[model samples]
Target: MSDRDTTSLLTPELEPQMDSLNPEPAPRPSRPRQMTLNMGPQHPSTHGVLRVVLELDGENIVSARPDIGYLHTGIEKECEVKTWQQVVTLTDRVDYLSNLANNLVYALTVEKLIGDIEIPSKAQWLRVMMCELSRLNSHLVWLGTHAIDIGAMSVFFYCFREREDILRILEMFSGQRMMTSYIRIGGVALEPPRGWREAVGKFLKQFPSKVDEYDELLENNPIWLNRTKGVGFISLEDMLDLGVTGPMLRGAGLKLDVRKTEPYSSYEKFDFDVPVYTDNDVYSRYRVRLDEMRQSTRIIKQALEGMPEGPWQADAPKIVLPEREKMKTQMEALIYHFKIVTEGFRVPAGEAFQAVESPRGEIAYYIVSNGTTRPYRVFMRTPSFGNLQSLGTLLEGRLLADSIAALGSMDFVLGDVDR
Candidate 1:
């Protein structure tokens, strides 16, 4: 056939329009669609392994959902298997930056269950000093890392310099820098080192200047201000509803420090301000933490200057380990030491909950003892877990870049959250 005849025979008006065989594609939706982005479980800014799923409309976060549990160490469950005293070490791993705080809270909780045990005045003072130093340490880390995240690299170096001094002091006290676990159940793990007063005095004397240096660097820098001031803000009501605490809550102008309100471990004996701010933003949180470091120094100075003269450990023979000299001299002391070492001290059959103001926020230990050496049940109401609940709230309807600042302001430790 001719080419025209063949083409016409094949065409048939494009095969009867093909409209009956297939309908036209539906019109595209008019509005643009959001896209989901996975931030990370390994993001350096997350402070640990924490993944944030963000639904973004262009560069604005439409919604944010945190995917946690990547760093679940099962430390809480591990606590149940450990002796009451052994668990202090486990607590040290929970919020490592605030290791002393965790150690103190767990120690205090166990002590509460062991009721009527008189922790020494010296020991109490020592605990206050160590914990406040821990607070300083944790806040220093937060400031350094947070500042670095926002492009202030010098602050990280300055903050870590002082932090190194604090870590050395911790090492001197407990022979370990990061996970000291120095606050034992009835008292500190050991007597304060001989030169501890001088060492701590040196750091405290120098620290205020370092904080001022940080302020000089970041407080007025236009880039820092633009990144933090009035950014990542949430109302006090929303914060409270989300269980936000620590600097995040304080930044909202609430005087809700657990140290002030509850006064555990002789916090009432110290005089300091809670450092509240009405702004409720990243800059406010930054200011609050800086002031907290100062207050912690005040508490440390008080603890050092007026340090009580007495035994470092409680007189409770059953709970606290006996002195080595006494163990060598007295048979009864030897027996108690052996017993406490071979088999852990038994806690009275009861439940006790003790809360403390950690660097992150309120970290409470809820413990049940069935009159056994091992805990019946151990649960930690960790601040990071509570504070992380607000991540989604803090990021929603905000710029995608603001998410890191908001996360850093919360200062959450994933180990604390996952436990």
Candidate 2:
């Protein structure tokens, strides 16, 4: 019952072994420290049903992956089933904003396959004018939406107000605003509607002032400048490697425009400068597109002033739709019209690719015909799909808040991307 007896009892019998009670701790599995976020298949800022899988570390993006196909319409395969002329309608849906550009490219491709069918000077000039107008329509939408995304609400209103004028002009010509389908294979759908000159001329006259208004609102605004000026930069080399085109490419100081370089639909005859900037940021893109709108206005003005006097459509009676007046009076015209409506005109066995400068960039159609009424193969090289390739390069290493500005600068249409 002394100290030795008490210590021996406590040490041997009463004490618990800590080592036996608890086992060794397991190590955590190796993984990245970044947080993953799915920005959208529904996010308004993503610009469409595009889902971006973002890997972020403390609000800085580590990497970004864009998920598409939500807007896919199987348009290429659908083109195979449609007749030569009927495919024009399908082209309209591919790039809804630049539907006329799509129409012209498809028409030009088909015309190349058909061989040596001359498009009249008047038709060529008209195509130039309409496509320029379509370019204005697209740039306006981009400006409004992009400005609003950056918290410049008033710029959006100003842009859309002018956009309404362009839409009215389109409606006057084609009887539809967005998807005109007015540019047919051989020529336009209808004779230029009455007062088209006055309407288009009026719009062109006032459009430069409207662009100046947008510049006044956004070009010098501190918030707009801070949000966009130094943000969303991708290298010219990266853009070229990734097939980026349009304002995004031009903003990087590359003077590549399909209208200027390739020259389809009489674009060569109309003179306009391709806007280029060396900044390669969202602000540069905005400036490039704005300048493009001004250039489009200039081309449209030239087209209106110097519209040639000739047949509106080509001389190919079989390929071009007969006039309503001619169809009523002549048996041959009536029969040809009936045959064309029921059985589409045959294109010679060949393959052709035509590229046009769409609002977003170089939009091309590669079509193959096997001496059939329908296309054997139809493939589109859409600008949105190309421009979207730069998203990862633009978003990575940048703050998450800047992603919206980066996305807006690309100006990609979901239909154009997923088609």
Candidate 3:
């Protein structure tokens, strides 16, 4: 072979190099470095069947997308087939932790459609008391599970210990612990059960101290503070734009509770302050809910001490069910009871929207009636669905480990989200 050809074969062509004094590194391939992770439709920290799609750059999240509907119940569509009265049972499952709050919002929406049906003052006060109790139940569950998510195991047991008392009180009133279906359209399903005052009074008396116990366990703990305090922050404007509500909204320093801003079910009669904090972070949300539990206790005390004396149900024989005793003795009462149970009472043809403060946030029901026994259309504006919208804003740009703290702070129920 020629010398030139042998030299060409021995040495490959080389690219020009930079000056030795100013050497530049070779450019890296321009492709995304992010990895996508699925956090769960089964992961325990999700608090329900929620799947979060996360894009991560190393240990930090680049973006997050909440993929929901793993727990969809089709409850709103189910309502179209059920009688107005029969639908109350279904509401209890929407947010099982706050069943009474669901029951109340549903009952209030029906009552509005029925044209100013006069709910007794006693019933109103009782509804308020029960709803507050439901709030406490929800907050307890949130705190317990959230603490455990952050590795504070002891707080879970302490929270459930107090929660058992609230559940007992609820059972006394409705005869069912979680799915009571106690709040009816015209009024509550039945008069407050005997000895309810004593049961609730005992819980109220001890609950403040129980809350203090939780505070001691979490508020000053270095591990908890490190995990939560400055993490999971989203701006107030972004939260509002995303339609986030409940303690998340309150924690961002916005005083927009449905109970306080738009009172229903005699909530105006109760004197309680809506807790607000300015931090707009996970710890602020924790503080707001703690303060809320105390306020709920205050409302329950007022309801217990000043419960009015009147018929628990409305005077409308056609709408409210007759007493069992009256049904046995009186033919008219028997017919009304039979009709309400079998045929269901017809609401006037109209549409009504009622919003109430549930444990998670502003839960509103928009119901349409065609002057029929069943609702024409039923739609629920659930807080979990609204608050979940902020997940992207909250988790993006945060450390992957911090996602758990941010998610736990939102306190969403999947049933509520997907219903």
Candidate 4:
């Protein structure tokens, strides 16, 4: 008591709690501690096994920390073990929603490394069409799932209806819906499947109206508007600093699409507007992706109409596989096919980075070839990883109820994040 009185500025009567050391724990402050919550190593809204640690002051989020790596497949290190062609399958698993884009970028990097390899015009156009469809497929899933996350459950059904059509198209080409890996180095996996044009034409014709239907359902709905608009705001400067791209960057009004800025796989030939929104909120990201679906339909229509008449693969027999029929009859073709199947083609010694605009964002593959059938080093600069870095920025100081909208707005694939 005497020590406290000597140290206190006020008189002994005014020296409130008496002892400074261990003063009855300050009566527990009469306030609750901020509750810490783990939102998904398996939460549906997370889109994958993404764990976000949130500190909540009542319903308001005090802070959020994203804990990732639960879905890590070690794909990059695994790429080093696979042949040049075999790595495409690994890339497919990197972003489950956008396998075609993965195939295209990795193939493009290999093509660049090989040098002087001419991808046929038909193949390029086909690649463009498939990739754009992939973009549509991805956005549809994002729209459906994100809508459901925000409680617009009906939109989810409509979005999945359209997504089924796109997946059917993919299956027609690759025999697998999600991991088609159709886009291959120097060409596509197959000459566009028979009746592919008719199938695509059917889907494209009905797709626009369906998109309009989604707008009808959600564009003006009060709940959707309330949950998304003016929520989860991150400045354009912050987005750039965090390396956020795709619709996230576009929503910030940056217009920084790798497709437009650095067109690959004949993307420069397409005429489609890059959707941009200046609001930089969850609603803005939603609008940008919806508009992107329309633009993708536009590109697909153009691709189908101007579909080229040429080989579907380059004239590199050593690199590209001969037809299955050719393998059976022609001894020379059989030998080459066997050789390519058993031992992958050797890429020239060099390094190349090929970045493509995937559904999520910029998906680039950096390949270092040491004159080997397998990559000496392979690295992926995935957009989900970049976009995930901004989760804290989006969630901090926001309401807990808004977390789903904020997370879904990023449209990140956990495989892409953890790869």
Report the C-alpha lDDT of model 1 over 153-196, residue by residue, as the tens digit: 99999999999999999999999999998999889999888999
**Per-residue alpha-carbon lDDT of model 2 for 227-270, expressed as tens digits?**
99989998899999999988888999999998888777778888
C-alpha-based local distance difference test score of model 4: 0.90
Compared to the true structure, candidate 2 yields what TM-score? 0.92
TM-score of every candidate: 0.94, 0.92, 0.93, 0.92
- Candidate that scores best on TM-score: 1
lDDT of 4 by residue, 119-232 (tens): 989999999999999999999999999999999999988989889999999999999999998988879988777899899999988999999999999987999999999988
C-alpha RMSD (angstroms) for model 1: 3.7
What are the Cα lDDT values of the candidates? 0.90, 0.90, 0.91, 0.90
Q: Is candidate 1 or candidate 3 better by lDDT?
A: 3
Tell me how far the alpha carbon of residue 326 in candidate 1 is from the true structure, in angstroms, after superposition. Answer: 2.1
Worst 10 residues of 3 by lDDT: 10-19
RMSD (Å) of each candidate, 1 decimal: 3.7, 5.6, 4.5, 6.0
lDDT of 2: 0.90
Query: Deviation in angstroms for 381 in model 2?
Result: 0.6
lDDT, residue 301, model 2: 92
Q: Which residue pairs clash in candidate 1? A: none
Worst 10 residues of 1 by lDDT: 1-10
